[model samples]
Target: MNFCKRTDLILVLITAVVTTSILGFALSNQVVAQINGTQQQNQMDYTGFHSNIEQIIAHLEKAEYNKFFNNNTLTLGHALHPIEEVLTLVTIPLSTADSNLNDTYFKDLYQLSALASPGNSTVDEFDNKSKSSIELSNEVVATVIPATVLSTTEHNVSVIKDLLTISGSEYKEGVAGGNIILELEYQDGSAFMDRAYTLFNNTQNISNDTQSVTKLLSDFSNLTDSVQSLKEPAVIDQIIQKMNIGLSPNDNSTTSDVSSSQTSQDYIDTIRGLLNEVITAYESNDKIKAKELTTIAYLDNFEYIEASIGKELSDRGEALLREKLREQIDGNASIDEIKQNIADINKVLDDSAGFLDSNPK
Candidate 1:
C-alpha cells in the first residue's frame, strides 16, 4: 500500500506540471497575438496617413499645373480645397509624431496655399513653394510610415476609389440643371479628378490587375475631359460606373473628419502658443521671424478653426484681427502695439472657446 501511494503522488505531481506548462505556452501565444494585432492597426493608420500625404503632393502639382499650364487661378484655388480637407487629417497625427515638423510643414503648406491663390504669387514663387511642400510631404511619408508596410495595394485602391467618388459627387453638385451653376464646386470637382487620376496612375504602375487597371485609366482620361467640358452629371456617373468603383464605406471618414477630430480648446491652445512665439520673436527684433510666425498662427492654427470661430465672431471680425497682427509685425509696431493686436485676437478666440464649450460637438 505504501508503494502504490508513492506512484499515485508522482502521477499527480506530473499532471500539475504539464497543465501549468500548457497554460504558460497558451498565455504567451495570446500576448504575441495581441501585440501583432496592435502593430497591424498602427500600420493601417500610418498607411492611410501616407496616402493622404501623397494626394496632397499630387494636388499641389495639379494646382501648379492649372496656374501655369492652364492659366486658371480659379482651378488652382479649387485645388487647395482638397488640400485643406486632407491637411486637417494630417495636422493632429503629424503634431503627435513630431511637433516641430508639424509647424514647419504647415508653414510650407500655408505658403503654398497662399502662393497658389489667385494673383497672389508669381510662377516662380508658386513653383518654389510647391516644390518645398512636395519634398516635405515625401519626407513626412518616410518618417511616419514604416518601409515594410509601404505598398498595401488594397488600401491604395480603396483610397483611389474614394477620391473618385468624391470627384463625381462634387462634379454633380457643380453641374446641376445641365449647367455649371457653382463654379467653385466645378473647379473643386476637377481638382478631385486630378487627384484621383494621379493616385490611379501611381497605383496602376505597380498593380497586377493589368486588364482592369488599363480600363480604369482610359475611363479616368475620358472622365477628366468630360468634367472639364462641363458634361452632364449622368455622363460622369456612367464613366464612374465603367470604372467599377465604390466609395469606401468604412475608411472614407478618415479624410473629412478633421473638424470633429479635435476640440476647440485644442486649436485655441495651438494658436496661443504660436502667438506667444510671435511675441518672443518680436522682442528679439527678429522681424522676419515674427512675421513668419504670425503667418503660421493664422494660416496653420486660426485657419483650421476659422469657420467654427466665425460662428461666434464674424468672419470679417476675425480677419481684421489677423490682419491687424500681420500689419503690426510688418510695420514695425512697438511691442505694446503687437501685444495689443495679440490681445484682440485672443479675446475673439476666448469668445469662440466659450461658444464651443457651451455647444460641444
Candidate 2:
C-alpha cells in the first residue's frame, strides 16, 4: 500500500509541472503576437498621417493652378473636396501617445494650411493671374460688342456694380463711387496712351504749330515712361503692398491713413452725380451736355491725385476730348447728328471706365 501511494504522488507532481510549462509557453506566444500586431498598426498609422498631408498639399496646389492658370472650374471643385478628408486624417494621430509623430504631422499640416490661405506670395501671384484672365476676357468681349450694349446691359452692369459694391463695402464703405471714379481715371489714361502713338506720328503733317507737336511728343514720351514704370516689378510690388495694407483687417491703422488720402465722401458724391448725368444725357439725347459732363466727371477724380501727375493726365484727356469733338462737328452738323456723336462718345467713356471700375488695380 505505501509503494502505491508514493508512486501516485510522484505522478501528480509530474503532471502539475507539465501543465504549468504548457501554460507559460502559450502565454508567451500570445504576448508576442499582440506586440507584432501593435507594431503593424503603428506603421500603418504613420503612413496614413504622412499621406494625408501630401494629399492636402496636392489639392491646394491644384486649386491654385486651376484658379490662376488653367481656369479649370471642374478641377477647382475637385481640389477642395479632399481638404476635409485631410483634416480628418491629420487629427487621428493626434490622439495617439507618440509626441514625435504628432509634432511631425502637425508641422506639415500647418504648412498646408498656410498655402491654402491668402497673404502668402504664391496666393498673390494666383490672384494677379486670375484677375488678368478676367480682364483679358472682358476686353475680348468688349471688342466684339458695341459700347452701348456693354454699358447698358442689365446683366453686365449688375455684375460689375455688385463687384464694385462688394469691394468698396469691404475696403472703403460709402466710397464705392470714388472707387468707380479712380478706375475711370486709369482707363481714360490708358486710352489716351493708345492714341498717343498715332497722334504723335500724324501731328508733324497735320499741325503748323511746332509747340503743339513738341508738346504732343513730350506727352507721348511721358506716357510711355509711365507705362514702362508700371511694368516694373517694384511698381507692381508697391501696388500690391498698398492693396494689402489698405485691404487687410490687421493693417487697419495704415489703411485708414491711406484711405483718408485717396478717397473721401465728396469724391463719392461727385462720381455719383457724374454717373447720373451720364445716364440722363444718354437717355435724353443731349450730345453737348453728355460730352462735357463725361470730360468733367473724369477730370474730377484727378483732383485726388498729386498736382503734377494729375494735371498731365487731365491735359491728355482734354486734348483727346477736343479731337473727338472736332471730328463730330466736321462729320455731322445737324442736331440729331450731334446727339448721336455725344451718345457714341459717352458710351465709349462709360465702357472704358466701367472696365477699370470693375477691377480696382
Candidate 3:
C-alpha cells in the first residue's frame, strides 16, 4: 500500500510539472509577440516621420528656388523654420530606436537651420547644408524601410506632375506679357519647375524607353529657358498636357484636379495633427483649448478642402465627424471615448484619401 501511494504522488508531481512548462512556453511566446507588435508600430511611426521629412524637403527646395532666382532670404528662413519643430517631434522615438542616428539627424538639422537663417547664410552654404541633410535622410530611409517599398514609379510621376502643374499656375500668377509682375509668385513657380526637372531626371533610368525620355528632357530644357524669359504659362501647361497623355491615355482628370489630390492629402495630414493635439489637450483637462483646436481644425483646415473632397463620399462623413468630435468634447467624454472617436475620424479621412487618390477630382 505504501509503495502504491508513493507511485501515485510521483505521477501527480510529474503531470503538474509538465503542465507548468507548457503554460510557461505559451506565456513567453505571447510576451515576445507583444514586443514584436510594438516594434512594428514603431517602424510605422518612423515611416510617417520619413513622409514629413519629404514635405520639409519640398519646402526647402522652394526656398532654394527663391534664393537662387532673386536672393530672397526672407522666404528661405520662413520655409525652413518648420524643420526644427518637426525634428523635435521625432526626437524621442528616434532616440529609442538608435541613439546615434538621432544624434546625426539633429546635428545636420541644426546646422542646416543655422545656415538658412535669413540675411546670414549664402546660397552656397545653404546648399551644402541641404545636401548633407538630404543624404542623412537617405541613410535613415535605407535603414528603416526596404528598398522595394521606397516608392513606385507611378507615384513618382504623379508627384512630378503635381509639381509641374503647380509650377505653371505659379508662373501664371507671377508673370504677364513676358515680364515678371510678381517676383515672389514667379520665384515659387520657377522653384517648383526646378524640382520637377530634378525628379524627372532621376526617373529616367527606370523608364522603358530611352528615346522618349531624352525627348522629354530636351523639352524640359527648352521650357526652363522659356520660363526664365517669362513666356506664356499656357506653353508650360501644353507641355505638361502632352506628358500627361503619354502617362495616362484613358484618364481625363484635369491637371488642377490632379494637383488638388496632393493638396487634399496635405490638408488631411494637417487635420490629423490637430486632432492629435485635441486629444492631448482634452486628456490634460484643458477643455477650452481642446474645443478651440477642434474648431480650428474644421474651420481653418477642413473647410478649405471641403469643396475639393469628393462630393459623394465626404458630404456627410466629414461633417458628422466634426460634429461628433464636438459632442465628445462638450460632454466631457472619457479618454478612451475621445481616442475612439478620433480613430473613427481617421478612418473617414483614409476613405477620403482613397477616393481622392483614385478619382483625383
Candidate 4:
C-alpha cells in the first residue's frame, strides 16, 4: 500500500509539469505571431507612402516644366499648386514599425520638394521683365516726346525765316535774288526747313522784280561770307562744356543749381523775342536790320535754343513733323494758313506740357 501511494504522487507531479510547459509554449508562439503580423502591416504602409510621394514629385516637376516653357518666365506663383499638394501628401499619417523611419521619410520629402521648386530664377525673371518693360516704354517716350516739342520750335523758326526773306527782297532784291544764305541756314537747321525754304523761295523769285532780287542776293551772299570768316569756335566749345557739366555725376543739390542757371527761362524767352525781331525787320522792308538781327540772334541764342528744343522733343515728334511738312508742301498751303495750323498744334502741345508737369514720369 505505501509503494502504490508514492507512485501515484509522482504521476500527479509529472502531469502538472507537462501541462505548465504546454501552456508556456503556446503563449510564446502567439506573441511572436502578433509581432510578425504587425511588421508586415508596417512594411505595406511604408511602400504605399513612398509610392504616393514619388507621384507627387512627378506631378510637380511636370507643372514646373510646363510653366517654364509657356511664359519663358518662371515664378513662385506657378509652384503654389504643386507645393500645396505635396505638403498635403507628406502630412498624412504613415504607418511604420519604427517611429524613426516615419520621421526620416517626412523630413527627406520636405527637403527634396524645396530643392526642386524654382526659387531664385522666379525672382530674377520677374525683376528682369519689369526692368525690360520700363526701358522699352522709356525708348518710345524718348522718341515721341522731344519731336512734339521741337515741331513748335521749328515752325517758329521757319516763320522768322520767311519774314526775313520777304523783307530782305523788298529792301534789296538784287542782293536777295541769288541769296543762298537762307538755303544754307535752313539746310543746316533741318531737312524740313530746307525743303520748305527752297520751295517758297523758288516760287517767290519766279514772280519778283529782277533788280530787287539781285540786290537781295548780293547782300545775303556778303552776309554769309562774313559769318564764314568769323572763325570763332566759342559757341561749339560752350555746348561741349555744358553737356559735360550736365552729365557729371555730382551731388543733386549742385546739379540742380547748375541746370537751373544754365537752363534759364530768360534764355528761351530771348530766342523767341529774337525770332519775332527777324520777322519785324522783314515786314518793315529793312534788309539791314533783318540781316543784323539774324547774325546777332544766331550768335547769341541759336545753339542754346536748338539744344533746348532738341532735348525737349523726341524722334517720333520729328517724324510726325516731317510727315506734316510733306503734306503741306504737296497741298501748297499758304504761309499764313500754315502758321495758323502750327498755332493750333502748339496749343495742344502746351496742354500736354501742363499735363506732363502735373504728372511726372
Please, what is the whole-model Cα lDDT of each candidate in the order they appear?
0.58, 0.35, 0.57, 0.32
Candidates' TM-scores? 0.51, 0.19, 0.48, 0.20
Candidates sorted by lDDT, best first: 1, 3, 2, 4
Model 2: residues >4 Å from true position, as ranges? 1-191, 203-206, 231-266, 272-361
lDDT of 4 at 346: 43
Across 131-204, the per-residue lDDT of candidate 3 in tens digits comes to: 66677766765564446655666555655665676567657666778887766557656766776677677664
- The sequence of per-residue lDDT tens digits that candidate 4 reaches over residues 176-230 is 2234333222222222222223323443322245764455445344434433343
Q: Is candidate 1 or candidate 4 better by TM-score?
A: 1
- lDDT-wise, the better of 3 and 4 is 3
The root-mean-square deviation over C-alpha atoms between each candidate and the true structure, in angstroms, is 22.3, 34.8, 19.2, 43.3
Among these predicted structures, which one has the highest TM-score?
A: 1
Tens-digit per-residue lDDT, 193-258, candidate 1: 776676666653445566756666677789888887778877886776555442232344433233
For candidate 2, lDDT tens digit of each residue in 307-331?
2223333344334343344334223
Which is the leading candidate under lDDT? 1
Structure candidate 3, residue pairs in collision: none
Q: In model 3, where do residues sit more than 4 Å from their true spots?
A: 1-75, 78-107, 118-127, 140-145, 169-173, 176-182, 204-206, 232-235, 249-257, 260-361
lDDT of 1 at 265: 77
